[model samples]
Target: MGGVAQSFGPFSVRRLMDGVFEAPVADLRHLGGSGPLAAFTAGVAGSTLPMDVNCFLLRSAEGLTLVDAGCGSAWGARYGHARAAMKEAGIDPGDIDRVLITHLHGDHALGLIESESAYFPRAEIVIPARDFAFFTDEAQRAAVPAARRGGFDVAARVRRAYGDRIRLVGEGAVTEGIVLLPLPGHTPGQAGYRLGSGENALVIIGDALHLAEAQAADPDLGFIYDVDPVIAGDTRRRLLGEAAEQGWALAGGHLPGILRARATEGRFVLTAV
Candidate 1:
């Protein structure tokens, strides 16, 4: 799969992971109503559905900041050739100055590792405080069902290796231009980032909206892995409304390209440009 690069105002965005499979549209009806199902079927076609799972690298005057790391070596069996895509983009793991993890999901955080060590040794790994607390707690891990326990394990290993370098940011400015907005419910402390100076801004909605068509058309739908479906749905609805009203550029963790169009009310169409 080929990666794409796009410019959103002052920030430069690039797709680090291009292809991944997701469930069919019919399966999405369980999430909410028929709107999402119809949008998914129409926008995404063909069997063996290959959707893009992107990691964005933002370059600013201060330094290079990565949004989410794609599937690491552990998930190679499923995603294949983890680091090759980033390498192709000319992003050296060592050159990354900061890594902002949207959540602790394996696919998003796993690629932080390189040669059995944390991938960005010189970079500070920023995570939401609530998510860090939940994922690192031993009791929480034991309480989760077996099927979801693997995620906790991955979180544990990341915490152990990068304890000192891990920085926690709540709903505020992590850096000068990057503001972390709490978008919770996808995971306990999942967040979206708003970049740029003022009214002209782009919201890096990390996993807050997974599939562009499904989410844009029906913001109430939830993905299967969503930790709190109700909250996720509500957040999605509110964010979509706000983004459309504000005319903000929206980017997502699993969206197909480096940048995707925000749907206008009633039209249900995407303008990628």
Candidate 2:
């Protein structure tokens, strides 16, 4: 969990560091090969990419809202420390009324359960409709590689625990100010939340670009975790263009910190905001 906090409109947001893991470079692929892109991927192949699993905690008059839950006890003791981080910050888990899931991946959804039950006793698990549909479909499990098939199990476990408490939605206003932005391809229904507007605006894009700098420079690169890599790249390109044009900042589950898109030469790069 992070001690730093930023304000967006009437909401105070905190990026809670849930866990950190090394993402293998081999998992990345170039949707379309470019000389520079191919070389970049090859250069990083033998190494691991360090990524942070972060969850955002938003506070407003509407109570507390959490964006994505860490992998609670899901991957064993190596992760799932976000709960303690929250407690350390004097946050009561029961106060969180909404746990907005970006996708059904373990780090994002499995935290909804603790001791084989809902972690937040009172929070409504708001999940993207498309993700809920696709991940839950046993038929769709075959769509992804066996290594990436874990989302199906994660989705089922979360669904079973949350049960009637789960709320499925497409792209729309989640509350008074927060809006869900449709960012598919990473998963069939990866959701990003837009907060505030303009220069001060912040968008919590979940795994849209696992490697912000690498992907920002070349939006065609995607992780093997992506169900539809092509669409994922498209979404990344669109979002980067939008952010650069709109002067908005982006935050993500794997992204280190808040970053803004800046067009350098003919390519775009992410600069810390």
Candidate 3:
């Protein structure tokens, strides 16, 4: 409906498509803080404190799938427009069958709730095993710096709410035609997903690239939430290089646009087409 739905690839089976699940930027700014706000404002003129929180719904034969759930109801008070966006995309939360969580960050997983329960009741939540452990472990929670403690709490609540629906996966193909590429460092189990085959492939990179300017131009620019900056930078460089060389469409969890890929300048760039 409208311009929210777009398609790629020459055929249905091989086609990679995405729908925008728009949420408010205010919620994102509040959660991400001033640093993210400053970065967004500087990169995109007129950008204010909160940049819109947009999630993606990917279509495949297996059924409707979601990339990251935007900040759910808890944070909805400030940024609840995501639900309306989903409606605009014609996706009923109950209809989503699978949710691939890129990491345990609050902004990404917080939206998995509905009335104090898992929002996607029948959906199987896919997460990295390493990240699952990291957020669920009490010892690890205590180890996080005071500033990051809130994130740990949010992640824990998600785990408790989803419980059995959570399915931990690793670096490899978890489903036919879909591959989970491990891109750790942003979190213990941060990951990216590759869909389709040959030249028709698309990769959904979650939180691996926060700001297009810093990530696309300088993969080395690390974010405050990156658990391992060095490793995260390396992963970004490697993924960016591979996507560019192979001519695969790339999508970032936080980046604007539905699909983006690096141009062939041997430098990181984003192609909205």
Candidate 4:
């Protein structure tokens, strides 16, 4: 929560741990049950998985930019500590000039609003074009399960607050040294931001792969929250492959801290950066 979590070129990335939660192993399902269940569960501690709810702050010559927002005042006592986290880091909400959202999920986008208004009033919100179109489409709500409609509600709230300040982007440069890479499947527009290139590269993938060890071992394992488990699995594997080959330092919405990917025969080994 203090100092640099990882550095990429001139950018210093720091993690802001909002809260923690326990995910039952039962919630993790494999694609068509094709992956090795025994090995996947064996990598996990027990039936319950304790994961960190994290967001990152990216500092560079371009100004203050946040990778993603944590759960705001909506998710209850276990979350919604953004203000406190920012205070601890000696930063004010207004100081953040831009916010690059990885997706439109509740935990990823709900922090945009605080006290029924824009929390980062001065910041321009950057979101994936696909996600903006999907969540904003009211007709898509009927197709999505009622339980998964929370992200839709979040999209509405964010739009109502930020209005024209939101910018829809594709897979390209969102700012100086930051490149948006489309890695959909969990959500239609879910993506990661690549900072720099090659071994020193740091990729911020939010909710792309939740259980670091298990998912890295077998990306075929998808979480219950995934909108399209099959596509999510494919995306996970693709991202893992890219990360490993490039020797990327990875960060995520649910990861505890920064990790580097090492490719073995068929799996990736995550080492703390």
Candidate 5:
């Protein structure tokens, strides 16, 4: 897959394309059956929607940090690109100093392990405490209502691979100039990382808004994967609004192309960065 790169102050932000998958249009029920949604789908005129699976690498003189790993081969054949994409960008997994995970969803966290080992062997893994508790606690795993227990099972595999190297973080600067902004509701601990010092900053919002075309058109519309649709909608609106207001570059795990966001006429718009 081809890679996309951008500079954020002294840090280099690079996009690693994992792969793409087709999602049914009905999956976007949050958009409702009328208004702009009808028009939006009519524009595409397709039964299946194309969604990109992406991960980003943040590099600086002091350290190398990765924001979410792509879906591993375990999820499906369409994913599993972290190692290859890094190699394409001339980066070795061992050279990464830290991995800032937004959440523990399979597509975002399964790449933590490769071939039954820690993919980035030397990097410190950072994750949200809420997610760590929800996905790793045996009691919580057992109570996860069956349908969602698969995530806990996969997370257990990751825990076994990374072991003591994992670090749980809250709302604050995780390292250097990168700060963790908790954007929950997609998952209890889903978050985004804020990087760069000034005007040239960017936020890698993992799964905050999967389809930029639809969500950017209407943030109130929620995806089926959201753990709490109401809260997820609020988080999406707030974060995207903040980004637009501050003129910050925005990126997402499932945005179709090189992602960036802006606001105009009371609506969020995305462009390739």
Candidate 6:
């Protein structure tokens, strides 16, 4: 499905597509547990699976809020349409009052800046404090194994764009109805943004569950980039459980289609609404 918009409580959320990319099956083997990787890719014809990159545009009486910036042109042609998608939804980058970053992952934050300029000129970029400190620390980044060094570079570039406009926040409401639901382990301070109250609420699970088919069916499945798979799995279970019990809607950063979901039989069942 194409990028769609939905409403809940006082917020209007529009799903903005950032294009798609293929992920190698070998890389996700660790998340499969005893379920063979072949089972995960059974229907797929290729050696890699396509993952959708999505960001959210939320509007309320208070202001416009973007859940995650998305992968810009920097990531190449496979995933760099966030800005265009936003415009298609009748929202502009400069009009975004707040940019709530789920994490500093290259795809989630690269769109925050373009050529070292703030993409959302007037927006206050709200970021998790733990992530801000970790990704921006040159020494700490260098300490990360060489394979993961590129993450630090992307974070540094995004940091340079926000400058003073960046606001570091801990667990709690970053704005009017938007609450930060901590979902660490994916990143040092990765989180999902909770909007609204009671049954009408929606939680944007940014990178908390990358492969929806595998992770949603089995929360224990770990992504390759999870900083702590065990903790991440626990967080996923708890959050999904709460969502199931409370009847709260869900949106994932890499979900295929129809962001709305509910946990049934310990698995997330997607809904068109």
How does each model score on lDDT? 0.72, 0.87, 0.68, 0.85, 0.80, 0.78
Best by TM-score: 2
Which digits, one per residue and each the tens of the lDDT, describe model 2 over residues 1-273? Answer: 674889887789888888888887766678666665568866674578889998899888888999999898878877888888889888877978899999989888788988788889989999999999998887888766788898888888888888899999889888877889999989989999988889878899998889888889889887788888899989999999898998989999899988889888988999987
Choose 1 or 5, whichever is better by TM-score.
Answer: 5
The TM-scores, one per candidate, come to 0.85, 0.95, 0.80, 0.94, 0.90, 0.90
Best by lDDT: 2
> Cα RMSD (Å) per model?
3.2, 1.6, 5.5, 1.8, 2.3, 2.3
Question: Mind sharing the TM-score for model 3?
Answer: 0.80
Q: What would the per-residue lDDT of candidate 6 be over residues 1-273, giving only the tens digit for each residue? A: 235567878988888788876777666644446565556557567677778888888878988888888877778877778787777667677788988989888888888878878878899989998888888788887777777666677777776877788899999978887889888888878888888877798888888877765676777766577777777888877887787778778887887654455767647765555
Candidate 4: C-alpha lDDT: 0.85
Give the alpha carbon lDDT tens digit for every residue of 62-143 in model 4: 9999888988777888887655878877898889999999999978888888866999979999999998889999899989
Q: Which 10-residue window in model 6 sums to the lowest lDDT?
A: 29-38
The TM-score ranking, best first, is 2, 4, 6, 5, 1, 3
User: Which ten residues in a row are the worst by lDDT in model 5?
Assistant: 28-37
Candidate 6: the clashing residue pairs are none
Hey, what RMSD does candidate 4 come out at?
Answer: 1.8
Give the distance in Å from residue 268's predicted Cα in candidate 1 to where it truly belongs: 5.8
- Candidate 3 lDDT tens digits, 128-236: 8888888878898788787776657767777777888889998898766678989987887888877775457777778777766556776766556677777888888
Residue 59, model 6: Cα distance from true site in angstroms = 1.3
lDDT at 141 for candidate 4? Answer: 90
Clashes of 5: 0
Candidate 6 local Cα displacement, residue 67, angstroms: 1.0
Error of 4 at 10 (Å): 1.6
